[model samples]
Target: MRKKVVALVAVLAAAAAGVVVARGCSGDGTSKEARPANPNGEKPASGTSPEDAPRPMGSAVTIVVDASAPPSEKGPEVLFSATWGGSRMNELGRSRPDEANPEAPMSLAMDAKGNMFVLDQVNGRVVRVGPDGKPESVIPLKEQEAAQDMAVTDDGKVAVLDRFNSKSIVMYDEKGGVLGEVPLEGEGLDELGFVTGVFVDGKDVYVEKEHGPLLRIGTTDGQPVDRTEVPGRPTRDGLSYIKAGIIEPEAGRMYISSVDRATMQHRYTREIRQGSEIRGILLLDTDKTGTIYLATLLVQNDQESVVLSCHEPLKGIPTGTAVLPVNTMPEETFRDMAVLDEGGVVYSVRTEQGVSYQKYDCQ
Candidate 1:
């Protein structure tokens, strides 16, 4: 039954390609309210329930997705919204295209200044948007095929994760000048895994290396600082592999996700490596709070995903647990997640159709 479901999901995702503007309900089965109350206690027309109030469901947080603006004269204006409690998304704002291409968008990043950086994977270029949803600049990369994940620094430096060449992480100045590249070394890079994402803090950069572990490196000279092994084994069902990870500097927390594992064959027999059985999002903290928040999705036997927060008061000690409510897209699967200073999260959901950008505000 699990195999059948997984196969069916893959088929539906492949069919969603090329089709623009697809609509579906969230796992919670709630639609976007036509008129909803504002965060400041003002009603907008949509009905409001006390239950709708943003609350923490364990590690699973509340999110809202809105349609900000429609397609513009050049084309449909790109709008970003959060997928919170209801099915409907909240309109954050529309973003204009820096370069025009009919291909669907893959990923996006927003700076503190409201400047939007869009990664058009198909075209192998990065597009920038101004606060008013206008095109600011278009950055063309020399090696488009290697570009995978991206991050923008507070000082406006752009870092692109390349999977093709020896240069793993490449940094560029605000004007698109080559700053430097992080040399892939140490036990983490020696595994020769693909980098899923790159995030920059003040002077440190955190990288999620696929199939290996989380790597921390210095941005100034690309020197490796530390490497943390990712826990969890792949399930025997051969469902998915580890995809991406995120780190929160303020909270000293880390989250990792798995997608599918690979099967290996020897001379006489074939062996299947069980992928990360504890498949979901994991929260790791180094602040002496031995608590770990885990969000898991069972894909092989059952199609269910939940969030749980587990804590240990003292080292090597155990505490109680709590379950949280998390809503996911029916067709879209979450690939990456990042936590903010206020305990909020921004995640990337990838589907055969397109990539869905979602933000979760957790109290």
Candidate 2:
């Protein structure tokens, strides 16, 4: 399989054909969010594909966020309210810096039970917050070490990318005890660079390999499962070409969103509905029923950009049937996003002030 993929890549290179790779909280900052030009300078389709007809986005209501009124300990400052049977935004909690560590969160992940895990990059610790918005445990790391991304399994195993200390990934159990650590170099993965994405689906964990395929590791003992390579435009990283990606593993299919630096466009997999106006997909997540939610950026102009929360159906078509603009400051950056099974979406919006989390309840 690897040989076949490599051969296919070689053929694409010979033809100058564009490929798709996949992104996350950490990005390479080479993508322009507005719908980009076709890399091959060819028109593929309009808004719909021939097999699956296009569906108009029905009326979906959403709340707007006030940029001036900052989030407080009581809750985040939400500007608007949702009508009956519509989605409403709710504030979870906020943190402040302390002498022991900077409590600011860098990345966010959620488990099946709705427990949230936060990577405090400034403090070099992982804090698990229960569904009640209270701290459960604070797992510390080596001094000066920081986590780039993290993933949590359904059984309560947490895997964190400890980049500063030996470029290793540490795994911890439910009680925040160390299970084991895997160094990227020991195995046959010598070409691997900084891991930018980590995802936990069931008993398996997938880690993004810089310029390489997604490494699937078994959660039981942290052993190798296999590698998945998605072809796409590659960027020259030093002397080696690397592709930065964001990955989400569902029951059967994997959703990948990547940046194609060759054409300065953002790309998604062919499985998705074609001609969606996402421009750039920053976060990919699915609910328990297999509904896909995308936190995307739409660049309107050089000075204006809008972040959208979109919902795509699983079977009828992959196009977003309902879209909501996250009515925040155009300058606010998207940090992370997660979809709840019962019916809500949690995402982080960051600015110079700090990071704030807002939840939209569609239930």
Candidate 3:
């Protein structure tokens, strides 16, 4: 089986001619909501290959966020409604001299129970929204730290990753209480900006090191630990670890593969061919049923848009796709997409009006 994939790699390499590694958030962005670009104005038929066809192709979720910004407790300063921002009043870093940018939310998260948690860093609080779309509560955060990323445990505890100030992961309970703080300043995790993701796998709290393997940094209780044996991002099923990567720069191509957690061997690899210019991978994740979801930024005909696609876990065969509008550079969500354990993804979109979340589900 490994030999077969190696042979496929050879063929792909030969086709590339000149290959270069590439990684990024997205390329030139547009404020307008994107629609599928089809000369016939129709989705690819079922007979189309996995590389072309996406079943139930690009079905838009009714949960589309309105173009106008909603109001929040922080007043209608023009960012997000429930999530506060754009003000310098009572900030933890207000005393600093070089403050330039307005306060905004850093990342997004959704717990298993279906509640949404927006990392409202500027407000120094995490806004919790119920499934019905009402603001439920706000989780207090360490004011001294400017949180970059965040993750929630299975039971609903929140962990915010602060890279510059505290250099630690502050844990919070489901009821908005502080659990503990796991320091991120030792050993394989020291250097500045080395850690990228914060995750809670089972009883342990893990962080991704350079988007490679998952490092066990502590427990869900915020107890610190130094371990680096995690094979990859552990899937919800606990049987495999999934990874996505770009193989060719000039060519719009990416490979998604699953690795057996126990053996640490590749289960399957599927290289999906894409647009004329590949911007960057926006989201790589899975739902409860082990169905893989991928969102990429691709440019064709000088127009850039995000393509959201889903794949089967067994062989990386694409299940479906949806072309989504992307905000022009200066991404408001930092670099994280919140994938709900139940079924879909929720990501914030920024425009001149304000910020709103775009929600989509895998069909």
Candidate 4:
């Protein structure tokens, strides 16, 4: 492959100065842009200075879809026709079945090629939609009755988590071929009920245990590993692991912390004081360049909205923020937001008609 003329020119300029600058991809075949990651792994003090102040912004909708049943080519897909499709809520606004949420498509994922995978669990299939908002194909999962969340690798491999009924994680190839299925219980994981989300890094499969530690359960081939665990969620670049928490819940203050993936040493913990009534954090993940993306559900004046904040890599420096509208008209959903390898996010919302997947460039 021929190098870009601009890259070659840049290399020559650097070499003329008696220094050879090497080009390196961040393990995703894309060059890692020079980011302001702290070189000394300094643990910056947060929540007390202007550097840790929050910067919030709003997001513009990129895609919208009306709900439709299977065998249709016009939608992200939904299953609201049957009597068992609705989730029951009481006067106190609590689900009767406890953790068994609802029948909507609980999760969504996107491949490196910008293809969307909607886990239509109620319909028993994974709906594939391209970046152009066109339906591509369907990956059927007839046996996943209570699949909670799913993650897709950069190469279009999929790992579906069915923690309730199946207690298993099923792996699938790009063509919807069954690679393997493995149990969730292992060394770092003990209870299936506490498993929160599924994540993919390289060939390894990790399941977040109750929003805490991530237990490396298996691989892309659907075989269980020997029960290794990570302290937090691994970034796509495989260089850092990040964990986030809401410290002053009432004041909407939060902190994002990370450690080096190799040495597991402290990197930085930056606190952000969001100027909204934050209900909770909705999403947290990184792009291929390790740029951090966080979504928090903010409520003010009895209205709830999702506020997205973008930060630079492991340093946790604020880049920008945006507000994503939340579907007040609730359907049963387990996962909503998915980050892209190229610094964007696509999230799904289920309505009375069908599920609509929308994209936002909060990064």
Best model per TM-score: 3
Q: Which digits, one per residue and each the tens of the lDDT, describe model 4 over residues 46-128?
A: 22233432222122111111111122234222211212343221000112255664355677788899887877676677767
Worst 10 contiguous positions by lDDT, candidate 3: 1-10
- In the range 1-363, model 1's lDDT, one tens digit per residue, is 000000101012222111111111233544321110010000011212324311111122112222222212342123343322211212111223456422333345566565667655445566675656555676665564545567776556777766555456677676766777766555656544455445555566666544234466657334455654432222112332222121211111222333222332110110111111223343322111212222332222233333222222121111222222233433221124333332333444434334444443211
- The list of candidate 2 runs beyond 4 A from truth reads 1-104, 142-144, 186-188, 210-213, 218-279, 309-335, 351-353, 361-363
Cα lDDT over the full model 2: 0.41
Where model 3 places Cα greater than 4 Å from the true spot, the runs are: 1-103, 329-332
Task: Give the TM-score (vs. native) of candidate 4.
Answer: 0.72
The TM-score values for the models, in the order shown, are 0.44, 0.54, 0.72, 0.72
Clashes of each: 30, 8, 1, 6
Model 1 alpha-carbon miss at residue 360, Å? 2.5
Instruction: Kindly report which residue pairs in candidate 4 clash with one another.
Output: 57-321, 57-322, 57-323, 58-322, 58-323, 67-354
Best candidate per lDDT, number?
Answer: 4
How far residue 38's Cα lies from its native spot in candidate 3, in Å, is 24
lDDT tens digits, residues 144-243, model 2? 2556677777666787765555566677788877777666554435644445466565555556543234565445345544553333222212111122
User: Candidate 4 lDDT (Cα, whole model)?
Assistant: 0.61
Error of model 3, residue 234, in angstroms: 1.4
